[model samples]
Target: MTPEEITRTSTTYNLQSWSKQKGLNPIPVKGGEGIYFWDHSGKKYADMSSQLVNLNLGHGNRAIIDAIKDQAEKYCYISPSYGSEPRAELAKMLVELMPDNIGKVFFTNAGADANENAIKMARMYTGRYKVFSRYRSYHGSTFGAGNLTGEPRRYPLEPGIPGFVKFFDPYIYREPIEFASEEAASAYYVAKLREQVCYEGSDKVAAIVMETITGSNGIIIPPKGYLEGVRKICDDYGIMMICDEVMAGFGRTGKMFGFQNWNIKPDLVSFAKGVTCGYVQLGGVAVSKKIAAFFDDNVLSCGLTYSGHPLACAAGIACVKYYTEHKVLDNVNKVGKTLGEILEAMKKKHECVGDVRYIGLFAAVELVKNRKTKEPLVPYGKDPDGVMKGLVGKLAQKGFMTYSHENMILVAPPLIITEEQLREEMKKLDEVLGEVKA
Candidate 1:
């Protein structure tokens, strides 16, 4: 459908920031319930990517909707400086839910703001100016947050801030070596970081930020022992350890936080999206007691007008209740395993499917020009041919919906997704792949 043909007022303004070469279709979504959303055209499609990989809980969650509505009716926006019941309740609730020792919380409107605040906190607490992040990672799009982003997406907004250093992340599929085992690859990455710290001076660095499981650039899962090694390294150097769980948090990996898989503790963890199952805008950094102490009458130079908004907190409280009461996380574990097996089985059959990296419900099917070489199907967002370019569009046309980015497709659905529904999406994907089955 042409953009001019459809005219309707959206509750919120839409951002026109997309690759003009590849025009945005801008379909108008009318209703969403469960994993499927119906566009204004009266057609329903799966939210396989969960709307920017947020919405860890699917749509039409009446419980969350009711909580938001109820909270809005009772009390809406309040200044961040003041105390609110839902705000305090969510803060305590999140602290309990996080790993012990992570006893502090600073809320934000989304992941970007959370990261910005975390950086500020780290710099303040450590009294250092430098922060490290791995290439092929995205923290957010805000000036400070986007500067911390290591991926090419950050290129447009360069010279972001001083002390922003980018480094390499361990990607096994495209390892620097001819070939290396997972253990060897991980060790190599650790050594690289160690060398970097020596050159950059760990004393000058405030924190080493990285995604537990790399999200947007590619679903690159760190090799076993990788995160633990980093945690130890950070401990040794007195550098604050930070994990960007913006994508991996909230049962996306079948655990409350993706870092749990590695069994390592971080000084601070930034989270959003799944905390409220995308019911409302909410994000925050789970700070340790050490950082929290800095807030004691220090005139903490960080806050948002909508920080800890009551409505978002209400959504978060209800979403957490849903996860705890209904075993949504357990469902993620079961469905995640089931999904992995099917995907691996498909990997063997499809040559374009080079690598299948997953952690629970969070999964990525890396598309490649050749399975042996593992060449990317497209360069970041530039896909000229319709083979890989039209995959999501084709899936939509086939009565299913998913997301594709930079030669990989994120198959993350809501944690509440059922095995039966999952298979249906997979089945549709199988058919869609046939059309571009290179």
Candidate 2:
């Protein structure tokens, strides 16, 4: 089909997510390679946000495509009850990549279901009802995962599930208090969390779910000792610590998992996105040894029709192999350093940039109308004027593609992106930010 036909068909017959349909002009992407994808009109775009930060291996990876083909030829559909080689191999690779405490894996179709199963397992194992997540988080949009979510997107699920609780992130830049050090800030947030847990009844809390690096919602890195403090709290209350690594796993954070940066072990780790790098949909919950052993006698109550699907598992195996063989993490650390430096310079050079937060290629630039007062370019969840939308559109016009949340712009390119490519794409961002009227 032509570009116009594709757009017309999609707009007429399909409903897009998180947008008003009438004026939607969806890109008719024909093909992509490396960090760039082109529309049917042959206009190429640098995937600065890695297409929702999932396409970490980037577009058109031959290994992933060939793996999918190879798996399809062998036989694709199989019941979850039967063991498959690709499934077993991928599961083994995942467990090995995870921390020492993690011992088993349960696969799912995507991140949302991965989180849903994680919550179920937490509740089943702890025999507790309440789960705590931060207010700035975006877990997923499924009914259960939506309840796990804490942002405005979850509002439609209001009067939500009975036991999900919300808390604030230790966003030091936005915090009113001026702490002397990161450790001090960590202490304050941890103390408040502990008190909140007490009020919520510690024994009744099943898990403390957190996005290890708080992706999309500002990339809010935790202060020093914050994660350790949360680990201690979970230990004290016998509450499971669940890290939602959906967007932060698979070398996105310069480590295998985001929690590894802080050297903390979560009882349950939910992951997706980067594992198969969007070549095929896949996600899983990696459980600690204790949680795994508990099901030895007790029933494990989670199930999915596509659970451990052989084709996705095959893609996952190849993806995992590509990560190591291509030294993806090393590239992330190297290019990510240059990304950080460039963003810091952009923050200094652009009056509209209030703060820049980054770790490994994952980052966000918070836009502010007034740097001194720190007034956001658009209010939280209230960009009624389409200010951010316009800004993102401007970047897109320059062939730099990314997305914005509230007043922050995401800058996560694919993991396979080189330093030169990063600098080139980021220059578009620099030029766009320079045009902002702030």
Candidate 3:
């Protein structure tokens, strides 16, 4: 179909997530290669958001493509009851990649299901009813995972499943109370969290779920010692620690996993996006050896028909090998530093840039109406002024594709992005933000 036909058919018959259907002008992407994708009109744009921050290896990776093809030719569908070479190989690879304590894997189609299963596993393993997650998080959109989410997206799914509790994130930049240092800020937040845990009854808590280095609702990196404090709290309360690494995993955060940035080990880890670099749908929860052993005697009580599908697993295995063989993590660390430097410079140059938080290739630039008051350019969940919307539109017009959430702009290109391409695309971002008024 032609680009116009595609757009018309989609707009008429399809419903979009997080947006009104009327007047929506969705981009008709025909093909993509590396860090660039072109529309049907042949207009090219750099994929700064990594197409929802999932395409870590970038578009059209031959290794992953060949793996999928090879798997399909051999055999595609197999029930979860049966053993499959690709599934076993991918699971083994994941166990090796994850923390030493996390020795088993349970596959799912994507992050939402991974999170849902993770929650279930936590509740069952601990025999506790409540779970805690931060206020500025997006776990997934499924029933259980959506309720675990702490942002406005959860509002529409209101009066959701019971036993999900909310907690405040340690956003130092926007902290209401002043602290002399990050250490102090970390202490304060951790102390308050401990109190909340006490009030909520520690023995009744199942787990503490968090996006290690929060994604989507601003890349709010936790303060130093903050994650360690939470880990200690979980240990003290016999509560499981769960890290949702869907967006921050697979070299997006310089490290292979976001939690690796700190000295801690979560009992359960939920990951999806970069497992196959969005080549095919594959996500899973990695459980500690202790939890895995519990299932050896008792039933897991969770299953998916598509769990560990051969094609997806084959793609995952290939993606993991590619990352290791090509040293993609090294590239992320090297180029990520340069990207951070460029963004830091932009923060100094642009008045609209209230704050810039970045680690590796994952980043967000917060826009503000006033730096003095730190007023957000677009208030949370309400961009009625359209300032942030217009800014993103201008960037797209300039052939630099990115997306904004609330008052922040995300700049997470593929992990394969080079220093030269990084500088070029970021220059475009700086130019676009430089044009915006304070």
Candidate 4:
């Protein structure tokens, strides 16, 4: 089919997620290379958000592609019960990369399923029902995972399943009151969370699941000692600390995992995205030694038919190897510093740019109408004016592909992106920000 035909067929026959059907226009992507993808018309767009922040190794990684092909030739699909070399090998590699506390892996198709299974394990292990997540979080779209999600996207999924509760995120930039320091803000927020947990009856709460460093909702990195506080709270109450590393895992934050930045070990870690670097669909829940020990005797009670598909596992193994051999994490740190410098310059130059939050390549630029009031360029969950949308449209027209949530522009390029490529792409971003009126 022609590019136009393909676009028409997709919009007409397929249902697009989280979008209105009317006037939906999507670019007909032809092909991609490292950090960039081309449309049918040959317009190349830099993938700054890494196409939903999953394509960590970037497009067209030869190693991962070859691994997928090799696995498919050997065995396309295998029962999760069967012992597949790729599956077993990948699982063992994950265990080694993760903290010593995490002992086992339960593979799933993607992040949503990983979270779904994690919730199930937490509840079964603790014999409790309630699960706590932050209001600014996005877990997944599936029913169980959707309920665990705390964002407005969960609105349509309501009245959601029972036993899921929401709490405030430590969005320091948007804090109502001035904090003496980030530590004070962290202490205050943790205290409030502890109070809420108590009010809900701590014994009944199974887990407190969180995106280690908030992803799409804005890269709201937890204050120093904040995650440690949560860990302590979970430890004191026997509540499982579930870190949802769906978007933040696999060297996104210059670390192997987001929670690694903090001195804490979650009881369970739900990961996806970078596991296979979007080469193949794969995600899994990593259990702490304690939880793995409990499951040795107890029934785990959760699974998917294609839990650990050979192709996905092979892709994952290759991706991990590529990340290690290419020194991808080091690049994330090196290039990430340049990214921060560029973003800081944009903030200094643009009136619309309010706050910049970044770690490694994971970053967000919060837009504002008035810097003094900190009034967002687009209000929370209400974008009637289309101001931010118009700005993003400008960026796309210039071949810079990124996304905005509320008033924040996410700036997560593939881990393999070079300093030169980042600067060029971010220059386009700077031009787009200039289009925004203060």
Compared with the true structure, all predictions reach lDDT values of: 0.84, 0.94, 0.93, 0.93
Number of backbone collisions per candidate: 0, 0, 0, 0
Q: Give model 3's clash tally.
A: 0
How do all models score by TM-score?
A: 0.95, 0.99, 0.99, 0.99
**Tens digits of per-residue lDDT for model 3 on 1-438?**
999999999999999998978899899889999999999889999999999899999999999999999999999999999999999999999999988999899999999999999989999999998999989999999888999999999998999777789999999889879998888998999999999999999999999999998899999998899999999999999999999999999999988999999999999999999999888999999999999998898888999999999999999999999989999999999998998898889989999999999999999999999999999998878989788889899999888888999999999999999999988888788888878889
The candidate with the higher lDDT, 1 or 2, is: 2
- What ranges in model 1 sit over 4 Å off? 1-14, 21-23, 178-180
- lDDT for each residue of candidate 4 in 244-272, tens digit (9 for 90 to 100): 99999999999999998889988999999
Q: Which stretches of candidate 4 lie over 4 Å from their true place?
A: none
Ordering by lDDT: 2, 3, 4, 1
Candidate 2 C-alpha lDDT tens digits along 263-340: 689999999999999988999999999999999999999999999999999999999999999999999999999999
Estimate, for each residue in 1-438, the C-alpha lDDT of model 1 and write its tens digit: 333454322213344554553345567778899888887768888888888888878989999999999999988988987889999998998898888878788899999999999889988888898999988898999898899898777888976688888889888778748545777777888988988987898899999999888887778899977888888788898899999999998888888888888788899999988888778889999998877877785767887888898999999999888888888889999999999998898788787888888879888888887877777888655777755657877777876667777888778887888999999889887776655544
Name the candidate that leads on lDDT: 2
